[model samples]
Target: MKSLNHRTKVVILTAVMFVLLVAVYACGILISEEAVTGSFLNAKRPPCLEHPFGTDALGRDLFLRTLKGLSVSITVGLVASLISAVIAVLVGIAAANGSKWVDALINWIIDLVMSVPHTILIILISFALGRGLKGLLMGIAATHWCSLARLIRGEVLQLRSQQYVAVSRKLGKSSGWILTNHLLPHLVPQFFVGLILMFPHAILHEASISFLGFGLPPEQPAIGIILSESMRYLSTGMWWIAVLPGLTLVLIVLLIDKFGDHLRMILDPYSAQE
Candidate 1:
């Protein structure tokens, strides 16, 4: 039967992504420093059958490094987005269920976070945290959770207004039990949608921060760092290394973001119709 749920189709796309990322990551690990360093005196070769994506100034294989970049971007996006989603769910539920002051405080902090320019705020936070992987992860995660918090808060609010919630209150159900049984189920769809939406932001933020030199180090196989390295080589006519990887990164981000939209459609058919 033709399915209305879209699970099979979505699962296919997810599997494709999972396979692509894992393959690239495995390639990154097995690639020797010798291959990337181009000790064979073949640095800066243009794209050809032997060096499909071309070679960088240092003689590194662009295809390998590009895959490495993809791996790093995917890893960063996953880590930061997951952390943000968890924090958002916890904080949003707290605000939704807590007393007046608690709700106000949560909203107020969310507001404060939203007021700043996100990339700049991330940089400042990363700088303050000593500007490494930890700093970059913390910065990306910290800058990107308000929308998730709002989503969770709205879900919780809807749950609170439901008839079952009132009955639970009258039936001597503890707040914890009510939250676990009734509210948590409703929260899942919202959480999933919020997670997909957060992913692109996480990736773009990581790339931008790294481009500015506050994120992943230059020697690492990060997209932003690759692009940064290409800037110096561009005038000399070796543009494929940076440009191709960058285009690949953009395509990957767009694919994931569109996939997220598809997921939201799956979870909220009414929203899709609208």
Candidate 2:
């Protein structure tokens, strides 16, 4: 059937994307840190067969550095998005199921958080937490939950009015029982799609905060730090120093974003039919 074929294609694409991501992560882990470190003899080299991404001002291998940085970005994005998604689900369920006063308070908090520019809010939180890995994770996890929470809240509210939910209520099912058995099961698709969508945003924010010198320590070879360092040598005709790594980061972000879109389409029943 057409529907079955479409589903098969979706599954194949998802699997491919997952494999690509895993491969990238594996490369990062397997790459030698020594290979990326500075060497006076190789310093300031341009892109060539021997060094594809070229050597930086300090002779650090840009290719390996970029891969390592990307791996760190992916790791941070994964962890932060997972935490944010969990927070969103919990807060959303509470907002939809709690008393009117509780709902109002949660909604108010969501609105207040959303009112601030996300980058600025994240910076403030990161700074407040002392601007390291923990700070970056907390900042991203705290700020990125609002939109997903709102989505989940709306979904929960709609589900609460469904016929089956009404019947469950009439049959003396407890709120917890209804939520666990009915609501949570129905939310799996939305949860996964939202989680995937959050990844690109989290990665970008982590890079942004680091670029601004408010994230991961300078010792870490984070993508943002690499890009930031490259900015200083751009005027010296070292175009490869910035362009290659920058392009790599952009490419990764785009791929992750496209993967999320594909996932959303596959998970959304109406969209999948189209």
Best by TM-score: 2
Task: Encode model 1's per-residue lDDT on 74-129: one tens digit a residue.
Answer: 88988999899989999999999899999999999999999999999999999999
Clashing residue pairs found in predicted model 2: none
Give the range where candidate 1 is weakest over 10 consecutive residues by summed lDDT. Answer: 1-10
Off by over 4 Å in 2: 1-6, 271-274
User: Model 2, range 1-102, lDDT digits (tens) per residue?
Assistant: 455667668777878998998898889878887877799899999999889999998888889998999999999999999999999999999999999999
Candidate achieving the largest lDDT: 2
TM-score of 2: 0.95
TM-score of each: 0.90, 0.95
